[model samples]
Target: MNTLTVYKLGRVEYEDGLTLMQRFAEARKQELIGDSLLLLEHSPVLTLGRGAKRENVLASDELLASEGVDLYQTNRGGDVTYHGPGQVVGYPIFLLPKERQDVRRYVRDVERCVIDSLAEYGLHAGIIPKWPGVWLGQEGAPDTRKIAAIGIHISRWLTTHGFALNVNTHLPHFNLIVPCGIREAGVTSMKRELGHLVSVPDVEDTLARHFCSVFESERRESGVSVRTVSITVLRGHGPEARVLMVRRIPERGGFWQTITGRVEPGESPEQTAARELKEETGLDVPVRALDYRHAFALGEILPPMLVEETAFVAWCPEGHEVRLSAEHDAHEWVSPNTALERLEYRGLREGVKRAVALRGELTGG
Candidate 1:
């Protein structure tokens, strides 16, 4: 069975995540990375797919801007949709196996992932005929409301821009647009349907598990053999948190990574994490071990090698200066989602998400 790597990107900007999807889709087309799923949330924003109508966006540019929502027209297959915090967005960067190249079947599989996930929450979700995505209530029923949306762009049998399921999303945000161009239908969320708050991480885990089941792939957890530490540095707590990421110098291939390094002889993973954080960014913050770990097979090796990682999260004040070491040329304090989108590796992206959740638990934020 093929192994599916899932990256939990807590929250990200629409454009940054889109660019990453394009890159991943291209890499999948080239057979570089295996089938991977990106789980994330977007800052308040509305996206217009290829079939989008401007009339669907009910709010004016000024109004949206004032509300701090960014708008973009995308190349996906559906109409206008709103994406924001509390909505779980899944982008599957997959190269369909030869026998499963049918786009409709592929979409149904994606819907199945969401449907099965909702089932775990005691919610029955199904497809509405003539419309893509998973919905609540019976098919063609007037009271049926959309609980999820799927918009995808496929190239050469590879896919990107998958689906969004409303977990704790603010329903009023959908009022700004005619969701998927369905005028009579309403939008509902897990929080509303369940009469309680549903943690995004809980939904994320359920979705990833079901996605793996539906795709006939093995779910490989990150961190298996290699001894290494991945630190997701944040500047604040809870919703106000911003992740700190550094760009490697030209000599190091110039890819972005969270604070990461191999453990030295006799050095504990926690010590290595603290040392790496200070060495990489000149930050001496306390490093706390997160519950997150990841393992991925190294690519392009004659003999396959698995790299294991233990993830950590560190808190620093907002305005703390990040002094880059020789290994890094630049640093940016980005949103947790942006950090996840910017990081090039799946392990680091998932590490950041784990760190964010840990922070929330510690701060009760």
Candidate 2:
């Protein structure tokens, strides 16, 4: 059996996640990594697949902007669909090695993973013959609803763009389009059917386990601490100082992380670090890019992205109040030790430790 590394990236911007997905597929193609699962939630956005009809999207650009949603055109096979908070979006980067190259069987296995997992949650999810995703209730019935959406891309025997299962998703967002170009059937979430909020992490964990069962891979854990292809800004100053940490919302994996964001075009890693500091936490502290730089695969095998990161420390000359962005649910100012204990990944904790070690010289303390 093959070993599968499951990467649980909490909440990533749609474009950022998409870029990494493409890279992961390439890695699999080149035999740089083994099979892996990329599980995450995208901020509100509408993705039009290669087969998507423009008419399926009903929302105007003005409305989407006002709602803080993004629009994208993608290469996957499907009609228009919404991916947002409270949804479990999974991308399985699998290579169809020789004997098991049947596309139909592969897709069915993907659906089966979801079906088996949802069953554990007390929802009997299955496929509706003509429909491509997992659905609840009998076919040709008013109560039948799509609980998961699957649209994928396979090229050079590699797979990408897996499935999106609605856990506690905002169903109204589906109203912005004729989901999968079907108008007769409606979409539903676990929350609506179970009459309570479903645990996102629990659902994610279940699905990962099922993937192992269905995909013939051994299970291994991976998550955010394996930060890759980005800049991390550790914000805080010393004298009596504390570093800042932010807790992500439950939908985005509910964990603590430092200020981090992608290095956008025309932006240096140092500039990106400083920008993320201001954008994410409303902080304007001075940023010093560390001499340390390293590259690692995003997770054990995810995006198998060989990320080159530039680390920075934002030293505050004095105390400043924190105003957080929507991505994080909570913020804290704590000692380096406390922050290290609270952080979820070794990658992040190490960054905090580095920041602490260099404080005196960086700030002229």
Q: Give me the runs in candidate 2 sitting further than 4 Å from their true place.
A: 224-365
Which of the numbered candidates is closest to the native, going by highest TM-score?
2
* lDDT of every predicted structure (CA atoms): 0.83, 0.80
Give the top-scoring candidate (lDDT): 1
lDDT for 329 (candidate 1)? 88
**Weakest 10 consecutive residues of candidate 2 by summed lDDT:** 225-234
Looking at model 2, the pairs that clash are: none
Give the per-residue lDDT of model 2 (tens digit) for 106-186.
889999999999999889989987878999989899898999999998987799999999999998988888999988899
Q: What TM-score does structure 1 among the candidates reach?
A: 0.66
Specify the poorest-scoring 10-residue window by lDDT in model 1: 297-306
For candidate 1, the per-residue lDDT at 156 reads 82
Cα TM-score of candidate 2: 0.67
Candidate 1: how many backbone clashes?
A: 5
